[model samples]
Target: MENSASNNILDFLIHLDPFDQLPRDIVATLASTASVKYLAKGESISFHAFCEQRYLYIIRKGAIEQRTPLNKLRARLGEEDQFGFTFLAPLRDSEDGYRAEAIDDTLLYLIPHEHILDLCEQHPELHDYFAATAKTRLDSAVRSIVKKEDKGLFFRSVGEVASENIAVAKHTDSIMTVAATMCGKQKSSCAVIVTQGEVVGLVTDRDMTQQVVAKGIDIHLPVHHVMTTNPILINSEDKVIQAISLMLQYNIRCLPVVSDHKVVGLLTTTHLVHNHRTQSLFLIEKIKYANSISALAALREEKQVIFQALVESGVSAEIHGQVMSMIMDAFTRRIIQLTEELLGPPPCEYAWMVAGSHARNEVHMLSDQDSGLVLDDNASEDDRVYFAQFATRVCNGLAAIGYPLCSGKYMAATPKWNQKVSRWKDYYSKWVASPEYNKLLSISVFMEVRSVYGKSELVDNLQEHLHQTITASPRFLSALTRDAIETSPPLGIFNSLVLEKGGQNSNTLNIKKFALNLIIDLARIYCLSAGGSLTGTEERFQYAVKHGTLSQASCDNIIGAYRFITQVRFKHQLNALTQGNEANNNIRPDEFSSFERKHLKEAFKIISELQDVAKLKFVQGP
Candidate 1:
């Protein structure tokens, strides 16, 4: 039989993160060695550099504020939050260490540093939980949730797995020569076609068999005749999962791995299969072959599993968004194909475009449909009627397969949104010339458009025109900046989260409206001002840095802030789904732990600072 005090400590430790992953026997051992101490409000605790014995302090009640020697607030810890991690290592005499002051009368559980060291030796994963930065801890938290088998695969880079034996050929080389090179010395399945010392095209074994041999084209002709010109390329530094995503998206088995415009290696589907098939890759394949609406709907259940897997695997936020967006793309493409099968081929060329989060490849479970149809200029009145009916079926089909219809009627089903290429150009021109508040909101979403199905050139032309128009109009950029900075991060005085005051979400914070949207706006403003068309938030920041619009340090801080906030929002939604609750953007402050609360405040502060920077840069003085 256990005493009540011991039982209480054990229960609390078992429920906390990182510890929650520990074995029961270890938890019992930890609880047995822990001692308790209480501090009165305004009392301070300090650790000397010369001290031989150190303890990891976990707050059991009240609050403890940890600060640097200069009195800068490093973190604020409340119940169940631990500190003293910095003292785990040996300290030198000249070291200016941290101080913890009790903000309220606090009770703390102290575990010897020696005990923690031994536990870490026994369990290596525990080391990440005690990492110095919030980002590292959040990453570790993500890893802790993943199944053990999947851990090694997610952390490995594409360069490590990609084959170094890259088969190379010149664009002027004969198709037979390329095939012979792939088969003979290179032992490769794909050959890169180089022209003037730059990679111009890709010729795969499939191309040799399908395009050259099957079509009975002259094998003596240049490989460029059969090769895919300007093929998709991946950087060597990108993660393996991203390579897997690109393969699944383009339905290709091979990709050229480039470093500084030079072909370095090749990443193929076989490489991914050797590692182990990720659920995301497999789900996309299943989605491609899914013939009926019911079959596609059944695949929806697997999406939650895939979402959980991706979250737990500790992949970056960009990868998360890309995977989810690819799934949406597959769904849309299949729906469009099925619609075409039912209602004859379209009379003219059209592009089905998805805007907003989906276009940015930042979609999550809560994403709604934001799509439009761009028809050719030559489309007749009868063509408009045909496309309208086609769009209705596609929208309803998407709603049936888990994606809800656009609440604002921004979908192709709306007659106003489904229009000709010339009409879209006029719309973009008008929006830029006169950007009122209501029109700016629509422009912000529409500007991030990507063609998911049909002719992509239509969307590409419109996007190019939009960028050209904005580049020429400084007033439009200023108006966009003013709109971007209109909604600041929900930071209350003293760096607290400003919660909703009333209605269904009373006492909760809308993470999307306050944090995510603000970051997105800043990214958009920076990219638009720079005349860069990248849509993803992180990529936009990187583009800004590359274009000298944003400093490297500022870009890094904003990226970190975006990743942390996005991870928090994702985990919240994952938790809600697991517990059979409706997943929404609203998060109650009470639901956050001390670790989350601290980092979230920091993230909010970063967003606010960046918003100010955007205002100063884009909004000229009157």
Candidate 2:
């Protein structure tokens, strides 16, 4: 029995991330002193109500449900999962320990807190393992909570709200009667025409009014003749917010909800619109009142509240980005105001320009500052000197307002970034007209450029001239493709995930760098080549679809990948912010489920395909 328990304990320790790297002999020594026990469903393991004895636990079999007042099962732990690191905190603060229960009949290996501490005290490596990875498990737990909240925006499943008594119509039914039945029921906005339980077409109020009534068609005409064929529809599992956005976007009043292409129910704008309006008002108010750093600090308090609010409102990510962009813009304007007061008056007329994320108006949660200036090209030499000094003060003040300085030396205060419009045009032209690697990399920065708080005509004219010159060069586009190609995705030989080896983020994949940048780069190229003028990745994809530069399937894959990565990155940043750690984009692969891992791989493959297409079309050699 002792040997059996020891084996289970050793197995569990081998899988625990920080301890997993230790030599086998050391792990074996630790496991020999561990006690493995069985836990029945709903049993309390770390009952602070009973005792203060600290114990480290490794779940060997079965699951544990975390109970909360919100009716939330915070997590269900499985085999080889670790828990009960609360011993690391002071006893007074650790009293609110997690309550564990067996989701199924289960087993756990427990190491006495005293023994664990003793072992760590003896071995520096073991101490490092526990110390470094303690926060990781906590972070993982918090991130799990954040994802639950993020996905909660659409948590209502089709099973919960979908109709059982769906209205149906035959292809041969009279259009007038179908319309009358829909109007009379007042509950049904659409009638699904089914042939052997397979969807053939969908008829709605708009079809009757536009196709039958206004056209003077026969009232007894077949419904199929008037109804829309192959209507755009959504799956029953989709969130109501998405359904509402689709309706608003396509100008359709209702969408058919399908299950395996069989009509399950009809979703209407009325249900979605009511919910959307309520949520959007709350979000707008929250952002407006987030006037100070202290006010914005509440965002880190509720992990995913901000992102969840944006997603559930069903606004396009582009619009959602703009909302964040506007908030940051207001925040920075205040920063400039404070700085101007500190430095007295500017010696000359100059326009402040927000660059990078703010310039693209793609500032979401956890973004830093990027800005510059456009002064009158005709300013005297002495006037230019004073203006530069004023610009430096503004940039420094932005840093004080919680906007961290750019690590890449791309801020407005720098002389290279701040310049006259005529010189800016010359700088842009040199890069666009040249075919060199460094210039192409610099130009890619311009891919997301937008004028914020500047003389509008100067920025507009600069863009027009730059766009005209860049598209004129086949060699420049090729060089851009080459620059984009350097960041090869971190995947194994068979396209399995490749994780970072060491550091605080060992075993995590850098999601934003390897995954999202591919989509962003591809979208940037598409926007440049097609004469489309949007900076955000989603807008570029939308424009590509409308202009026929990208097929529907290609657009779907690209947008899906972008959305998934954005969601993951936002959650990662939220977790970092909560722990008072600097925000970052790296995410551990071990934290994701098998299905999520699969989707990440598929997204990377789609990006690789897009790059291949771009290489063929634009990455031509000299």
Task: Estimate TM-scores for all models.
Answer: 0.71, 0.53
Task: Give the range of the ten consecutive residues with the poorest summed lDDT in model 2.
Answer: 494-503
How many pairs collide in each candidate, listed in order?
Answer: 0, 1
Candidate 1, residues 1-622: lDDT per residue as tens digits? 5667767789988988668878888988888888889999999898667667788888888877766677755556666767776567667422357788997899999889888988989998788666544445555554444456665676577888899987999999998888889999789999999998798899888888889878999989988898899888999998877777788678888889988988999988777765433644567778888888778888887778778767767677888898888888998999898889899999999999999999999888889999999999999999999999999999999999899998899999999999999999999999999989888977987989999988999999999999998888889989998887877665431224332122132477788888899899899988877779999899998998899899887787788788888888888998999999989998887887655764576676567667777888899766
The top-ranked prediction according to lDDT is 1
Q: Model 2, stretches more than 4 Å misplaced?
A: 1-320, 341-349, 493-507, 579-581
Which lDDT tens digits does candidate 2 get at residues 360-456? Answer: 7777765776766766677678777776777777666556545678777677778887778888888888997875777766666655566555466
Candidate 1: where is the Cα deviation over 4 Å? 1-150, 157-209, 216-238, 255-295, 468-479, 486-507, 579-581, 588-590, 616-622
> Candidate 2, overall lDDT?
0.63
Query: What local lDDT does model 2 show for residue 476?
Result: 69
